[model samples]
Every structure is written in C-alpha cells, then in structure tokens.
Target: MGHERVHLLKKIQEVEFAAVELQLFLDTHPQDQRALMEFNHYSRELMMLKQQFEMQYGPLLNFGFSPSQYPWRWIEGPWPWERQY
Candidate 1:
C-alpha cells in the first residue's frame, strides 16, 4: 500500500470512531438533533473515503461492496495482518 492509502485508512478510522461515540450518546439522548446531524455527517464522509480507497486499491469488504477491474483482485493483496499499515 502507498502513503496516501494509509492516510485515508487512518482518517476513516477516526471518523468511524467519532460516529460510534455519537451513536452511544444518541442512545441516551434520542431527542438530540445536533448529535444526530454530526453522526450523519461523519457517516457520509466515511462512505466517500471508503469508496475512494476501494477505487484505488480493492474492496475493503469481503463481499462485493465494491467491484474490481480484475475478478480475482479481492484475493490478490496481502492479508490484513500482513499489511504494514
């Protein structure tokens, strides 16, 4: 993987963390519109980043979330634990 991909993955992790935190907060404060908005914003950002990453590399998911140019690209890369990033 390249530097840019690592950066994007890190960003996705950060955004996902924030979204999960907001979800927990919303669980206690279901009436809080502000927290809901923030969660939605982060979710959208995360989706876009995931899409970009998949386009440049391969599917981040095990299923067919993102299509690949090569049919077998999904199994071509190093396993997740083997990746340096």
Candidate 2:
C-alpha cells in the first residue's frame, strides 16, 4: 500500500516479465548462452525481491512457497484481488 511496496511490486513485475520473455527466446534458441545467463540473472533478482517483500509484508502465495511466520501470517495480509496495486 505504501510507495515503497508499490515500487518493489513494480520491480518484481518487470523482472518476471523479462524472465518470461527470455524463456520464450531460449525455447527457440536453446544454444544461446547469453539469453540463458540473462534469464538466470533476472530469476535471481526476482527471487530476492520476492523474499524481501515476503519478509516485510507477508507471503506472496498461499501455499508451497514462502515460509510463513508464527501465527500464520500468510492469511494476515490483503488478498491479491483486494489490493490496489
């Protein structure tokens, strides 16, 4: 809800988009090492951002993803559809 949270979410979206695009490229050009490296870099960035967001805000997923804190904090935050972005 805050500006910082919004910015981080935007960054995560951007990195995820890049990763998807690189994946598509690699699907056709499987031997392109450069694309593979770029995909890995973006994947790493996305993972870090997701971890940071989860630590500060809450789990971004409902199950089988980020570890929940004590008292089950995953259900404590706003649902994705309820958020204003």
Candidate 3:
C-alpha cells in the first residue's frame, strides 16, 4: 500500500479504538459528562475518518457509491476477514 493508504488506515484504527474506549468508560459511568463528551467527539471523528477513507480507497460501508458504479467499488478493498482492524 502507499503512504497515504497506510496513514489513513492507521488513523481509522486509532479512531475506532477511541470509540471503543469511550464506550467502555460510558458503560460503567454512564452519567459522566467528560465520558459523554469524549464519546461524541470520537463518534464524529470516526464518521469523518470513514468518509475520507471511502473517498480515497473506496467505500468501507454501503452508501458511498452510485448505481452507475454497478457492482459497487466498495467490494474492491480488503474483505472483512482480510482486514486486520
């Protein structure tokens, strides 16, 4: 993979972990304002990261392509099992 792809992948993985961490914190301390803030922040970051990844590499989820793309370019990337993250 190129440097851009590697960087994006690393960033996406980092954001995913941040989301998971926030979820775990919120699970035990559901009313904590700081945890809630962090959760929202990470969630937004994840969305932006996913969008950038799709715009560059291909859709990681379903909504990014059009009917004109036919079979969908989303499937072009590494499959679920093929992905490490």
Candidate 4:
C-alpha cells in the first residue's frame, strides 16, 4: 500500500476511535462540557478525513453511504477499507 493511503487510514482510525469514545462518555456523563466539546471536535475531524479519503481514493463506505460517481464507483475492486496493512 502507498504511504499516503496508509497514513490517512491510520489517522482516520484514530480520530474515529476518539469520537466514538467521547460519545460514549457523553452518554454516561452528559454534564461534562469538556468531553462534549472534544467529541464535537473529533466528529468534525472524522467527517473531513472521510471526505478527503473518498475524494482521493474512492468511497470510504458502502451500501449507499457514499455517493456513486460516473461508471458506478464502488463496484471496483479493493475498496479503500479493504487494503491490507
């Protein structure tokens, strides 16, 4: 795999984990303003990272999560998430 792709995937994974963790924390402690702020930050960052990945390497999702491009994009082989480390 290319270095750029690997780097981006790793970063996306980290941000995704942070966002989900913060979300769970907020669910249990809704009064924690700092956690809420952090969650929001990570959520936005994750969205941007997904967008970047999709724009560069095709859809980062499947089953209608990503918009279809000309010639039906996701039908191609080796999706972004399918790359081996």
Assess every candidate by TM-score. 0.84, 0.89, 0.76, 0.89
lDDT-based ranking: 4, 2, 1, 3
Tell me the TM-score of model 1. Answer: 0.84
Candidate 4 lDDT at 17 equals 98
Query: Can you write out model 2's per-residue Cα lDDT over 1-85, one digit (the tens) per residue?
Result: 6778778788888899999999999999999999999999999999999999888888887768778878788777465335464
Whole-model Cα lDDT per candidate? 0.80, 0.84, 0.74, 0.86
Q: Count the backbone clashes (under 3 Å) in each candidate.
A: 0, 0, 0, 0
Cα lDDT for residue 35, model 3? Answer: 85
Which parts of model 3 are misplaced by more than 4 Å?
62-71, 77-85
Per-residue C-alpha lDDT of model 1 across residues 5-61, encoded as one tens digit per residue = 677778878998999999999999999999999999999998998888778777777
Q: Which RMSD values do the candidates have, in order?
A: 1.9, 1.5, 3.9, 1.4
Q: Give the per-residue lDDT of model 3 (tens digit) for 3-84.
A: 6777787888899999999899899999999889989999999888877776666666555342214456756756422544
Lowest lDDT sum, 10 consecutive residues, model 2, at 76-85
lDDT of 4 by residue, 3-70 (tens): 89889999999999999999999999999999999999999999999999887777878888988678
Over 4 Å off, model 2: none
Give the Å error, residue 26, model 4. Answer: 0.6
